[model samples]
Target chain A: MFFFKLPFLNLLRHYGRTSLSLVSIILGVLVIILGRGTITGLRESVIRGEIDGMTGHVSVLPADYPTSGLLHPLDGLYSLPPAAEQWLHANAVAWTRRLFFAPRLVSGIDAIRVRAIAFDPATDADVFPRRDWRVEGRIPETAGDGVLLSRGIARTLSVQPGDMVVLETRTVAGAMNALQMPVAGIVSTGNPAIDSIILFLPLSAGEDLLRTDGAISHVSLLLGRRTDADAAAQQLQELLGEAVQTTTWEKEAAPGLEAQDLRQRFLDILVVALLVMAAAGIANTVLMAAYERIREVGTLRAMGLTRRGVAGLFMAEGFVMGLIGSLIGAMLGAWLTFKYSIEGIDMTALVEEMGSGEMFQDIPFSSMLYFGFSGRTILLAIAVGMIVATISSLYPAMIAARKEPADAVRS
Target chain B: MKICEVESVCKIYGRGAAEVRALDDVSLVFEPGEFTVISGPSGSGKTTLLNMVGCLDTPTSGRVVLEGKDVSTLGERALAHVRAKRIGFIFQSFNLVPVLSALENVETALHLARFSGNRRKTAAEMLDAVGLRDQMRRRPTQLSGGQQQRIAVARALVKHPGLVIADEPTANLDSKTGTQILDVMRQMNESFGVTFLFSTHDPRVMERARRIVSLHDGRIAEDRTREKPSAAGEVALTSDASNESNA
Candidate 1:
């Protein structure tokens, strides 16, 4: 015997107001979905760049080393302790050692002080993206006297592969040392910092130039997943004891994450503001409807509709309005995401045009970026819309409920 | 037994220099099955009296007893409960919900009254009683004024309320339609034995009422009763003492 019917007719009575509310909610949901999708895309790209083409999941350093930055003094070098070496072999998917120094690269009159990094070229390819580096002559072998230079450095020297170059740096004993080796290949990492001043060579060539036997700078461990970096770092610290220090990719990428965090906070504030505007708009419309139908409300009350019953009707109306608007919004958001996902945003050109900034140093800064989004984003938008609408309806519904039936219909 | 008792109730309006007594200590009792009208000129308090009797307003002084409960003694919630179970209303403007069809308008009352039955079937029957079965699916806007008022009457009587209050129920309709709608109300009263309290400025409505209470200056100026209400209204009043002589 239920006779209280749909309140949709009331909404239909005011087409302009209803459409306005719907459009507001649609835009709000679109903003939320797009913001979330862009952030997710950025995060994924950064993690892939850092773990695969640059820093491994975790890096090990000497406990006595107080700070982390480029070019630690040559006197502060430490070897991989036997126990930590064993731990790396047992737990890590791949591991590599680096012997690095800031050296003045010289080829005739053209010279620049560049960060020289030596690697075990045999296992180095397992932890970094070098298999795709274009080769003019040949890649460096474990026993070869060949060296790799970035495109920027080669341009600075006006040299190419098969050309001879001299690397000059001071040793641990304050002795100046130099080595002349043929350039093996010129690689483009698509990252400005790595491309500008990086030099790669065989691990033996670096040890020979430094005049140290079995003395390496640090060990880097590549885990199967980026998310495992923190846990692996913690475990390595315990295994290596107090004499060694461990750091994760997150600590290294703090600056970039901090910028991302600010963007996220700004988006949160924007979402709240949008919801408030939507609430105000809907509240105004419902209030007007209540006022316009005062006499009808009075008639219903006299015929026995309770105050609670009246309030319930308005609440249902609000819920339905939000449900419809958000649903359409979700669909629109999905369509937009699909469009951009197929045709990625040109981020490499964008980053290049803007020059290099301090933000997102860990990210590879590739040529194209596709959004990462799921159905969850759409569902969250709908849920947020419904909650906002229901809350907005409260005050107006209460006013309608508390109206005096006797005076409402008079005159 | 008395269906409604207005015990010396007073309703005042305005203040000081503009103070006016809308109703001043007026008392009246209505029996079951009585088709009564509170008649007066504009500002004569006929509507105010109807409001007091219907429990839509609280009297400034004294009390209104509906069925067995004193409305003044009840809280807003409890009074609403009484209104839900015992009262129904019709308006001069034919205040039907424009969004709803004629059947739905009648069903709304049954729903609110918590009538535990097939609401649609009962509402359809109620509309049929007012000769609106064919227009049961029409919204108020789609129906003629007479048809809408007939739907209003059906809505008021659908729940079989103890008292049906109508304020100027016929003022908006033409002479013919107003009489026809009144005839529907009169028939419902005689057949169901339910009480009806209506206010009107129309003499045609008064002619059909079994009891006429005239208000002037917030007071009961005249109270008249007819032994048997006539369906022919003014025609019976004019032709009359012998309209019964033929019988």
Candidate 2:
């Protein structure tokens, strides 16, 4: 058939209009790709920071601990049996026990509210390595009257390493207890919330200050891979039964993570909406072109071209438009991503307002982003373009086909 | 054999009070190898009658028989099939697709006729026959009026259609160019045994036709045959022969 040459030459002949439409489609596609990609990147950074800094892939807590809503005073730590600890040691790649509570720290006239975590420095190293976490000084070598204060809290108290700090908290019997300890370190994590409020102490010192005897809050476990976390959680649930609650990192940090997931979903919806709008614009452009060529269509029809052939010509034009637009958009999007990925988008001012030290501080942008480019997206776009073009051509093609050859001759 | 037969054909437009009868009880027969012209002013229904015979339009009543089949009763697909296989059309404006070269436009018709293999070669052959082989690669816009008309002729004849319908084929050209186109049609009619039906108002085209049918007010005003030239190449008038017989 002479179909191949006609549509291609037609597009070339009307290069101005075709190029205009191609620009619109490319811009639309670029917006979708960049918008979705940036949002996903942000969410992933947050999730990785939270999971790696605090909770491991999975954590086990007391069975009586409330799973939903805010934690109450009655929600005490879980006490794992010897068998349970042994089971975790055998099954998990890395695991640690932690005692977590909110307490008061006092230095002279300064008093600050803080979250204190008691962890065995040796076992916890595999999960939350203290060496990289410490901004100054170091983790206490042994269980002694020593504490590590986040930089923000340390600044507020005008205290440093070797300075005496007082810690106070309520016992299970509802009585307040206090202990004087030497400041062991002042840490600065880039996260403002964590840097300003967290106070870490040796397990034995936390035991003494809180008046708790050898009791722990939770056992957090890290698997070799994130994929193993879910299955291990399920296995822990079955083995521990009703005596303990086992949760994956997703469940433990559901609130913060859910918000991130919602943002991702919104980006997806926006991308799809933009694509649909672009498709409509493409349909309109092709339809108008078809209308302008009514006489040409009539000529082809009178020459014995079938209705299908006439429609196919227009559809092929649209498919070519889609292919060209998508290629240009992908390249443009990748160039922009590369340009910005290196310098990064600064949100420091915005981050300060949100009570974080740096909102997106030098996001170690991955050298390559995974673009889910399969035959499916390209094929679908082509199919949609063709269908839209064919449908839009129907009225004009039919009008041409039904025209009297005599009328065409008269004109 | 009758190449086209229209029996009791009626074509009406609109409804009731506003209805216009384009063709009323129009019956005509076209014989093979004849150059027949249907000439009339605008709105005399000449074009409508031609469309019905060409299978481009259907009559509201009666039947149009083309090559032994009743075309008026055929569905759109079947009508298209018949048009593709048996009929070719030349339009006055030379409605060649502007995107394609002159050769490509002619080859398109051959493609539709299902002529397989070496379409371009066949198209060039048709163009060569029309004395347009040199201009085959030029687009329609690049060609002169007479050249475009020649390309249109090549397109119509590429499919070897048994019948050729030219609807005012010379309306857009000058008198000289129109005469050249008429000469081509006359030569094709004489050499190929293809039936020719022209709906035209050009006196030159009418004079060249072997049989002239004049239409007025939706009816035939006159149907006459001119006398054939003698072997010595002298023109003879049939009216003169009739008057001599009366004397």
Best by DockQ: 1
Docking class of 2: acceptable
Q: What is the TM-score of chain B alone in each candidate?
A: 0.91, 0.91
Query: How far does residue A263 in candidate 1 sit from its true spot (Å)?
Result: 1.8
Instruction: For candidate 2, give the lDDT.
Output: 0.71
Task: Give the Å error, residue A271, model 1.
Answer: 2.0
Show the lowest summed lDDT stretch of 10 residues, model 1 chain A.
A356-365
Per residue, candidate 1 scores C-alpha lDDT tens digits across A1-411 of 232245787788888999998888888888888877776666655555555555678988767654433455667677777887888898889999887777888998889877777888778777776533555556677536578887668877888898999989887788999988889888766555565567788989888888757677667878887789999999988987777788877776665566667888888899889988988887887788888888887888787677887787787677777888788888888888777767767565566566532333324434345676778987999899887886788788898888888877662
lDDT of 1 by residue, B96-128 (tens): 999888998898888888889999999999999
